[model samples]
Target: MRTTRSRTVAALGVCSALVAGPLTAPAAADVADLRLDQWGLDTVGAAEVWEETRGSGVTVALLDTGVVTDHPDLDEVTVGPDLTGQDLSPDSDGYGVHGTMMAGIIAASGHGIEHTGGVMGVAPQAEILSIRVAAEADAAGGGETDPGALAAGIRHAVAEGVQVICIPLPDAAFSVQGDEAERDAVAHAVDNGVVVVASGGADGEAVYPAAYPGVLAVGSVGADGALSEFSSRGEHIALTAPGEEVTVLDADGGYTTVTGSDAAAAFTAGVAALIRAEYPQLQPEQVAEALTGGAVAPAAGAEQPGHGAGVLSAPGAMAAAGTTAESVPPFDPELAEQLADDPLVPRWVLWTGGAVLLVLLAVVGLVVLRRRSADPYGLGRRTPETERRPVRGRRRRGRGRRGVSR
Candidate 1:
């Protein structure tokens, strides 16, 4: 567990108020036991991904509660500044629980000989930069949710040259809006070729950074692959992943199950890492395309309201990365048509504009025809003097290359 602690810590406490899960210890588990519990890995085709690349050379920035660096399963993690100003100790109440859980989902390398025990991550070979952005909110709303700190954390991660940034907390978790510093920070990350993955929130509508453009907003899905009811629904959702009852590492170095879009975002971030590692030359938006292009639509042949492209497919994303091929965006035609009716220029306005253009063209054509009819030559506009003076030997045709006898 390595950390670069900040000299000045803010007094505002932080904890997980966005996700819902209770930390419960289980008996010592081996790799087999943990693997059995990780239904998400299989759902996202992580096994197939391991055969290609275990996400080597990819670093994911986890902006959430600080991580438990010493967790047996978490092999690669660098704890960054404690921006939340909460106690940095691992034993602090709910300090790093959520972040640790998210980290495990992203890149826990497992423990023991041959790495066969503990929680295995989607990108086991990937690295984690755990930045303590916030923690569970206290009962009295004492959790310090600083938008500026989050922005700083994002910029810090980008400056560190991380390949991906995972925000386990939704925009609603902290009060933020588009065009704020946080939004600009997100933009900066994207512009710098960093892929940003964020929770779409558990509530109905997406908020803030998740809803911001270029952020891959993730939703939650259960073992059955159906969208989780608790997962937020919005037009911004990029895709769904296993988040319901997903097994993760607790701060106490034990295994526990969590259910929320937070886990989904983490898992998606890991997928992005895998894509980045496999296709290093691909830009951030191209990596995002691979994710959406490789996703599978729902069984009903219709996109769920907020499921974006569909369920994520790890192998599919790898195959789709760095390609210029187009994939169908998950959208309901009926709904899209309804939305399309309200274009920036109303249908009536467009019709009027077209009519005016046609009228102008017709009037110009009429004037040209009248002019040509009045003057059988392609000379200047006809005048009484030119009409009266028919002294020319031979009139030139309509702008032809023939010489006019003057």
Candidate 2:
């Protein structure tokens, strides 16, 4: 097992080294031309929602490795305390790369890296509070993230009055069932009216924090609007967003693309920030419902196990009501008896209804059989022959012209 893990790390190192080449700054006009390349933003209708709110006055707490405070895209980010005990600066190189990537996806301003059109987050005006819980190397070293640090980070974010908390790292990095302390911390944040969003895991298994109640578990979708093959599948998923080949700013101030549920979760958090900023009176649960209820349905024939409510629709959510409908009350025998006594229809009416349904079914079956006979393909239905015929258009070359030219 140790040897296998070492080989995996070595392979990943080589790939990273190959892709981490120096980047050149592009002209300012290049940024404008590449606006459509931010497919994630376009997918969620971020531009329409931006007309109302760009997540102004919202603070999103990112719990992960750490962030690059100096990254031009993250100049507005506030670096929080490092709980990893590495004595690493918030903008430390190497260890905080993953956290920095997630942060850029949530709040990057497309500043310095704009040459590659840089990266623009869903909520460019939102503030990021960087809370370092673990380093990127810990996972590569075959060690799990410190559960204690994760729990502490949540509590700290809540105390700091952050409106949204994003945990892009999966719970598997710590435990299968998850750390009890971390679950409690997430619950505490929710209770305090802070929306907690977490990755639904890259593997097809339930992960912590996201699996916990009151926390929105976000899955991933590809640019084609299909569920990402690697996104975890489960009932815990609350919503999905584009994650495949998502552009993010590295700690070294370079642009790169990443694929995973983590990117989806960060984008969801940005949408949550937009909601919080637009509707300050909404509760956490209400915000979750708006996002889920307003989601755009996935494309037909797409496997939907990993996609919860479907693709995140920022404009739809912003346009939705801030409150979810009240749950129906529990069954009451007394009310049932009272309703039973006041039947809207006589008992004989039910018998008539059954007979009518049977007749309707027989008529439908007869129609289907007649249509199938006329349709040579037995498609169970019929279409006009003219409609099935291919419409022909004028040929580019006439027969006489073609022969003479030949």
Candidate 3:
């Protein structure tokens, strides 16, 4: 519970999109319409993105398992990496497979590769830099967890000068804390002006980067514009995105409806890309404002705080950015439904999210308990957890001598 959203805003530097709410599964008939670009806002942002911007000259950093570099639909995406390893698409496991789907939403280009599959990229012209860190989960529901790799990826992403960084993974526990490398990387990205987009964890507790003041913490919303059960809440969240049933290509060359903050994040990232693509003149801050401010509040009494401004509407966003799209009123559920009948988001997001929240509480409890044992005034506090004296070269006060007491 940190109260300040300043850091979250700085990190995301853009608005997050809220899903229309849980959607029905697409019928076989709907499958034919399946395209990676099937995000609800796809049509709305297309004109602005295609005519004004294709995410061209922009590189979005997908800091996740990894993007499917060789996918037919991902011609525009360029593979980038961290200290961990390669950017292998169609790889085994469920880990980074999600990354490809997320990337497709932001910058998939189905041309050149035949039958690129059900998903089409949102920002077809935008490029992607892969920052893979985690491994796919095994049947036992466990895989190698590597925060270091995540930290490395963040730094690498900043160094590479990515304009947007999508962090799909949630830190294990807020108490787990981020490694120095990760914090420094985020700081560097902010200093250099990279917009960071992250998902709110299943837990109500805000996760890092997302919780971190500069990051744009995002929660999930469904087709009805109601907050998804799985979407994390609280002050850390800066916006919401279409998280349920959105279609994207998997690493295994299949199309599936996904429901996670990750998918929502992808759509949000795409929206940001659309704005940047159209209004390169708009700074990250301005881009965020336009997206959040332009979003129509969900129905009356349905609005939630921390989700920020409102659900993203690409049409509204374009208008706000002054892209000259046709003048249109805020979102109307009936009108949107008429435009497309697809299901990428589901209602179970919350039921599944409860477990996650429990874990976060445990982490917080542990951290608090540990902190109580340590000396509160300890200046030796290091990052992550526990406490320690300053590293070598640092001096401690002796008698106000103001000199190194080494």
Candidate 4:
């Protein structure tokens, strides 16, 4: 099989961690061998998407691990940059395949690539913009871990005029640096009318870039339409996509889904490209609307894992975008109420009240303590004679009022 590029949500990871299945080989692809439809991939709907958009002139940027551009599935990844400083060659460690997997999901053309039987992408038509940010954390050995590299890569993608940006990698620090950088870049794109799709972390929460406002945070669903334990859940999730196990050449060189949300994120981004093409006049908000509006609610017993929106429905999204349906739904009342009742409150308001109360309490307590500390006696001073009282009459012996001792 031909080697190509890179490749979940939080719950999916948890499930994968718990699952112990024998490593299965990648699907030997023939149209008949394509299990995607059986897995509920909606290939017919994808064709409907191609019938309209064909992802023409659209570029989906993948910012994460390095992509193997030479993979047969990724022939359309003609333009990209190496943001990560590791080897871009095909024979790198198994970990470096993350980006390639993502690229495949967005746009791999692996029709004839040899030895590359199973790992096919969702969007084989869209062009991929690979901006590798972090170094290999896998078998390719490790490389530098710079948050700045990720920021710089985002800015560069914005400058490059890509239509859609997909970010699957997450930062462990949980600070706002990467989030701010990615958000700013996204805003820059929005000003130019670009759409961004991001994958939440495979652990517990939506990662930076995805967690930021304005960007669409996508989650994953298993074959049964249930939320994988690894699929992160929260209000941050804007939509869900299929994220079942796909055979990857794991660390043991055996095929199995070591992980897959990265693929889901890319797949969703590809769908975004389709919507963009069909409704070229729609703004970023409108595109987001089309996606969220079209998503199917999560499968039963798994609804909590959804963004309250449904799984990725590419056909539904395209159809929704083509129509003039009411774009964005009103905010959820429950969410609004919860936010309003938040006890933490705003920082400035909390600090202001705290400072005012602190000063007043300090002043009042100080006045009381000062009065106490300043007092020589509790109520009034006790005269020494009052205390000694001339030793109650025996004092006359020692002092004699000058000399009578007995």
Candidate 5:
């Protein structure tokens, strides 16, 4: 695993509204009032999307530092293996802080007393699978987390049959050379019809495995629907979500607002969960298309390079029709012909050609040796110096004593 300086944006203190006072308890008949303070809910049309599905059957895998499984907002979270090499419990305070925050953003259920009118996620009913792959020590020490652990976590999520994999960390956590195992694991997830969502880096550079093909790269946008300056920009970005000033439950049982592409990715993953629950038959690519195609255009003058399709709209995606596998168009004949004529050969063919060449060279070497051994006086061979000595002696005697002496 490659190590580098930490690039994750730390979570800021809770939003001002939550700090003012404890939320008033909702009346028994009005459960909708419980989430009135969640601006993100309304901004992304979560309430309307909830009418169709709350992501009941979808399981979103959170591959991060860890999660506070016992938090009021995260009652439905299931703690998975700790790939970070830390033996801490899922609800541990110090190490799992970042992962806990992301969990609240995705599937916080708000089940405890202190959270009665607290933070509610986009997919309030979705289940969270907390897979701890990021190391707290590495992060604090300004070192990159293990990419192998991340790759293993992705494979584990796929094996568990998760519908969505949410990586709420930045690009710097990955190696510059790109870990082949991590990339292959992500590809495996996509091939198995799993939606992989990752944060576009905060420093305006493309990041992996977000930059990898078939992954949904998310950028950050603010509540006002403008692109956040810190959000990374690139052609790989698939969509933008409300990332700035986004309120989420922290590890200390408090609400806090975070700003970065991590929050955007978590929010986008939640939206993906909603889509999966509403349209279980849709393939990963089709689900991605729904999110991108259904995104609302940003306000004038607010668009940025990484602000991909636009800001996420849960209601729009949920209401959008699902695409069947057969709906995809066939490959164009011209493109197919071009590919056939391309000089780049497949890996298997290259290996086979190399093996054939080695065999041919060995056969040629053996044939040359055999031909030389069979005919000692072959045309290509030179006569021994001893045989030519007699001829020279005859010539010298014939010439005269003076010639021989000369």
Candidate 6:
């Protein structure tokens, strides 16, 4: 129920691609070709991922403006709380503009018998849990950014058992310095095994929630696979995705081209959803590793300025996930038995112990020499057994002396 006065900007720019508002139905065959223009989907390798899974059975918690569920391409959308304290009805101005765009980028289902036309998200089968945490636009053409609402939304999403949480604010709408509530909320989500994804801010600053320790901070890339001019740089960036001029749903149920960190974050979240759907048992950090570890940079060992690990590759991530899953063997009593055949102590430990024993014996011999020199009746003093068995070097001399005397 917390609120704030800080304004949140949905995207850096929004340009009308097709006519805004409800669109006339196009030819049935032409509908399927609508996705051909969506270069962002191809950039992220959504087709290859579709062959495996479309993020089925995964729910993405979108903490942003409210979303419009009537979009033809969008699948199931469950509306949650409205923390913005504003009217989120369809009649409202700028109703869910940004949120709708993010939803489409994550899980927009094509419209038609063949599921063609409109936008197709990376994880088209994934469901959406919409929680309005900020206003897309206000009456004066400006809206407030509420970190309090964001924190509350995160906790609520975790409570709802969401696998992935997406925050599409690609700008530093407000400062999160010393925002313990927001920090704790993100931590709570990650601790519950939820994968938190956010944009690194288009203003070239590493923003909060995204800057939070466990969240996956995403950056922006263009269709050419180059870093976007607006994407933020620095160590906080974890991955990059197509964001500039990306195709998404407009507030009026039509398609539009928008540019910002929002698309980047949404695409990354969709990838996270796909990973979750494919490997439900993978931990949050392991999912993140599959993403960053599998990203392909522009060149081998060459770093992209703001592209984090590099551009997101869905197939590569899945491959890395496979390797990771194979390496992390599941619980098996037979596997334990297989390892039990090996020695309990390592070779290094045995070698080290032997060397240490030799050193200790030498030290004891030196100590005895010193003690015998100081006190004739000490440890070095000869006992009866030593007298009977003469010292090796003296035994020969003693026999020769006995022979000479005889």
lDDT of 5 by residue, 41-62 (tens): 6777877877778889789999
Clash tally for model 4: 39
Q: Residues 114-221, candidate 4, lDDT per residue (tens digit)?
A: 423333445556777778776544433243345566667767777887778887663332333355565676677777777878776554555676677677887777
Descending-lDDT candidate ranking: 6, 1, 2, 5, 3, 4
Worst 10 residues of 6 by lDDT: 8-17
Shift in Å, residue 207, candidate 4: 3.3
TM-score of each: 0.70, 0.70, 0.64, 0.63, 0.70, 0.72
Query: Number of the top candidate by lDDT?
Result: 6
Better model by TM-score: candidate 4 vs candidate 5: 5
Q: Candidate 2: lDDT over CA atoms? A: 0.76
What is candidate 1's lDDT per residue for 1-406, written digit by digit as tens? 1122221111010012112232112222233455787798889988797988999888999998788777777888887888876547655666686788889999988765456556678899999998877765442234445787789999999989899999988333634356478888999999998999998876666576688888999988888888888777778888888888887777766767777888889889999999878776677898898999999876542456878899888988988983543342333434666778776668899899999999999999999999889878766785777677546587656854556654
Q: Which stretches of candidate 5 lie over 4 Å from their true place?
A: 1-37, 91-93, 112-116, 137-139, 171-176, 323-406
**What is the lDDT, from 0 to 100, of the residue 186 in candidate 2?**
86
**Cα lDDT of model 6 overall?**
0.78
Q: Candidate 1, which segments miss by more than 4 Å at Cα?
A: 1-31, 87-93, 138-144, 170-176, 322-406
In model 2, what lDDT does residue 115 have?
21
lDDT of 6 by residue, 32-105 (tens): 45556688888878789788899988999998888987777787899888887774675476778878888999
* Predicted structure 5, TM vs. truth: 0.70
* RMSD values, in order shown: 17.8, 28.3, 27.0, 18.7, 14.7, 13.3
1-406 per-residue lDDT for model 2 (tens digits): 0011101122223234337753322333444444555788889888787888888889999998888876656757888988877768854456567887888888876653332344578888899999988767435443246879889999999999999999888434634577789889988999998999988876566778678888899998888888877787877888899888776776765666677888899989999999888776677888898888889999853455778888999988876734432332333445667779966677789899999999999999999888777986855544586367777998785557655654
